[model samples]
Target: MKNYILFFAAIWMTVCFCSCDDGRIYEQKVDIARGGRTLKLTGRFSGLSNWADGYSVVVAGFNDKSEYAVITKSLPVNVADGSEIVMTLGGIGDEVTALKLCVVNRLRECVVDFHTIESEELAAVTDTIMINAGTLDVGMYSTIQSQVFDKKCTMCHGETGSASGNLFLTAGKSYDAMVNQPAHKNSDILLVKPGKAEESFLHLVLNRDGDTNMHHLDLFSEKEQLSLKLIDDWINDGAFLNNK
Candidate 1:
């Protein structure tokens, strides 16, 4: 009986060593998209351990060269058993090719684990579950902006900004070009009102339709739509007048 008891204890320790907080492993992901030239990003994380406090969450993606790499920062999800974190990519510098999520123990050895990500999966994460507060720390921003600029805007305008004919969508230049352009001051007509994304040119292009049913694709999902609201609020909030 003593030998059997010792054997069971040994097995328990082995299992604990290999597993995360819950003695089980899970996968999570992040999603990113654009608002015209601005590299806007938001994503919901799933697969939370029953005890998820202080777990370091990182969103990683591929650079232009198609190499897997970290986005230069770590996103922190505070709370034990915490399964989700909503992040925004602020002031990102370049484009992205692929995405993934890294979950660190934040305990034990403080080691990290990774999972590949996809646009659709990310959309699903946000769609099915809410990302609590929906804000991004600077570390989280790296992944957010990278994904948004690369996945959404890069194909069209090259990076977040840098569009043709004096158009730049890069997050850094997005707000500026839109406000300064005299010829196209109201060209798209999306930034005038806050909280009302429907009136914005971004929606027109994104939804691929207008009062005339222009017949286009509504690329964003329901969750993405909510993210748009957050963005519009920021813009309507005087576009962070500190910059204006």
Candidate 2:
């Protein structure tokens, strides 16, 4: 009986030791595979109301060549203004060249990049990376001006030579020129009638079926739905210059 008891105790000790050793080995392997990489973001968003439909704000990782995101996490939209935002992107892969805080359209294409972490910065991260993006005001009208009018319309509208239709889309002049003002092409309709997108001539010219010159609709292609929505929502929301 004494011999039997000693044999069983020895076997139990061996099993326990093996289990502990295996656990340590597994943990080490996992750590090596993961490289202890992580990204932590802390910030607050202002002008939350400016976010339009069919678009989402996201924290995304991307490669240098593609506009499409490699990995993305949607941000909370229902939260009140100035609410603390805490997010983490862990186990980042080597192929991911950059990380950005931006708005993406329904197709997952980045519409605008608000903040970015370049590849060099990402490569230097040893363990946990921390980013404190101070208050961001993501207003829609500003986005429309930069992404739409600035890129697509400035040439004919106001950037150089005579302003076509006597309208200036240049900054500090566009708002007063469009809001509550009559369209030069057609004096019967307002350029942008606050609280009504369909009634606004600006929205009319952008719509494919709207009552305007076909050339106006061709200026912005169908792929630019995000830009169209921004303009539409801004008008629907009273077309305010500052939506705080």
Candidate 3:
């Protein structure tokens, strides 16, 4: 009897949580009046990056005439927890008897819907968002080195920095070889360009997309250029040792 009871309880719990609103319990509610109707339609949700950053809004009544639909798609600015956002129905002046907001995240794998009660008292939402100030004061080149070492170069490059061809990336000698190395780039390829710096082999190495036997840094590319800027800034700023 006890075993059966436990089994049933588990099933009940699963059914309850398999809903959009409950998927990411991180929900928020914002009270607002829409279209001269004192109703709440949606609440912003926060604390996510692995989810889709877009969603769709829907409103309907008994007849198709009262039905309304719209899509909400926007790029999100990352915050401490996730991205900050505002939720709303896309249409106005439509006789909205019932409203639903469905969200699609970054991966577009998870889809959830929120609903409003009446035409007027529609929005009873949950808004959850975390705001992060956008700032990259860190040096650009060093950041590149850090990324190359931490994410890209480190794997095969090795801690000793001499894993392949004995080129040597070991901390003490890694920077030197990278700065003005000729053998690193192929004959037809000039990875790093000195003086100008931007046209260097390092740039080609990180941004390489052709048949260069090297595994590209697709995952690391988003911030790699910015990191280069930081590195360039550091060199111009006296190349001070920021041994972070």
Q: Whose TM-score is greatest here?
A: 2
Q: Which candidate do you rate higher for TM-score, 1 or 3?
A: 1
Instruction: Find the 10 residues in a row with the least total lDDT in model 2.
Output: 46-55
If scored against the real structure, what TM-score would every candidate get? 0.33, 0.62, 0.32
Q: How high is the CA lDDT of each candidate model?
A: 0.41, 0.79, 0.40
- In the range 1-244, model 3's lDDT, one tens digit per residue, is 9999999999988888787566455342222223322222322333222221132222222213422232233334243333234433333334434433333223322122333244434433222111222332122233335434555566556565347644555444556665545654464433344444445555545455554545555645552454444444434443333322
Supply the TM-score for candidate 1.
0.33
Runs of candidate 2 exceeding 4 Å displacement:
1-32, 35-49, 53-55, 62-70, 74-88, 91-99, 105-109, 114-137
Clashes of 3: 31
Model 2 lDDT tens row, 43-122: 98865556656667788888877878878877776777788889887767788888888788776787777788898998
Q: Candidate 2 vs candidate 3: which has greater lDDT?
A: 2
- In the range 132-212, model 1's lDDT, one tens digit per residue, is 334322232232234443445555554533464355656555555543233243454643343444565544444545543
Better of 1 and 3 by lDDT: 1
The RMSD of every model to the true structure, in order and in angstroms, is 16.6, 6.7, 18.7
